[model samples]
Target: MNWRPGCDLAVLHLRARLMRALRAFMDQRNILEVETPLLIRAANYDLNVQNILCQDESTDPRPLALHSSPELFMKRLLAAGTGPIWQLCKVFRKGEQGSYHNPEFTMLEWYRPGMDVQG
Candidate 1:
């Protein structure tokens, strides 16, 4: 069956372009840019996402699975040494496909160390 292809790359690029405004906003406040992992071990069991599980064929769960987001790990970074970081990358979903849907798609995630989600 043929399916409609969404421009996820366009979505990613648009996302980056949009974030430039936010980055300027952050930069005005002296916030620094940081990068977290695209793959990680643990993830939130949340409602917005249905995740695809990926195993390292050669590693035998050494790294385990593809991350839903770098949220948990990024938060750990905040706890350790970094502060107020943002990340953008591709992510996988368990059972989704269409023009507005892709099995794997891009995401942008950010966190403020001192501020809550409302901020």
Candidate 2:
């Protein structure tokens, strides 16, 4: 049975709870929440990842790619000294749907300056 969006109320409730929990966790760690653009000019050029592109007159007449992750821009912010920032936003990918994956989904990304994976 296909339920309308509002009919699926449990999912919404779960999402809200998760969001609040994440924010509190970040706040405890003194990490700042940020927002980034979903649309980007350049597509990520990895081997398997494909990007969705769209033509728009607002930014450019040419096709613009939807960002798969906020990694690139986040790194730029890190370089510019915006330290310890995290973002929870929607990202888009092309040809990546599966039983556990979707083309469009919410992503949580963060960057900490002067910190490496080993640390």
Candidate 3:
């Protein structure tokens, strides 16, 4: 059986459980959910990320890059005094396609002040 149709339901169930758990986990510690821009003038140049490209209405040759990660902008927020923030967003990358991989994928990222990746 094709699994694509079931993906939506699976996503809902998983997202619900994950979101519920995370919200409680973060709430207990005073973190906030946040939204970030989906487009960017430039993207993370990390060698690991191959960017998926898009064009704008102005037809700018340097079309806005789909955000690879909101990490950079989110850092700016942290610097500007926003408390801990978490986000779930769709980010794009080029040249990846598989049963478990897509050219674009959902990413869950969160940041807490005074906590490192080890935390």
Q: Is candidate 1 or 2 superior in lDDT?
A: 2
Return the TM-score for candidate 2, rounded to 2 decimals: 0.85
**Candidate 3 lDDT, tens digit per residue, 7-97?**
6777889989997897888788888888898888875666898777778767677778887888888888999999889887898877888
Error of 2 at 15 (Å): 1.1
Instruction: Go through the candidates in order and give each one's C-alpha lDDT.
Output: 0.70, 0.84, 0.82
> lDDT tens string, model 2, 1-119?
75556447788899899999999998988888988777887747555789988888996787788988888888788788877999999988899899988999988998777779973
TM-score of each: 0.62, 0.85, 0.78
Q: How well is each residue in 1-119 modelled by candidate 1, as lDDT tens digits?
A: 65866566889789788878878887776665667666656654566876666678676654445666667767788888776677767777667788788777777777776777687
Q: Worst 10-residue stretch by lDDT in candidate 1? A: 61-70
What's the CA error at residue 91 for candidate 1, in Å? 1.8
Best by lDDT: 2
Model 3: residue 89 alpha-carbon error in angstroms = 1.4
C-alpha lDDT (0 to 100) for residue 13 of candidate 2? 91
Candidate 2 pairs with clashing backbones? none
How does model 2 fare in lDDT? Answer: 0.84
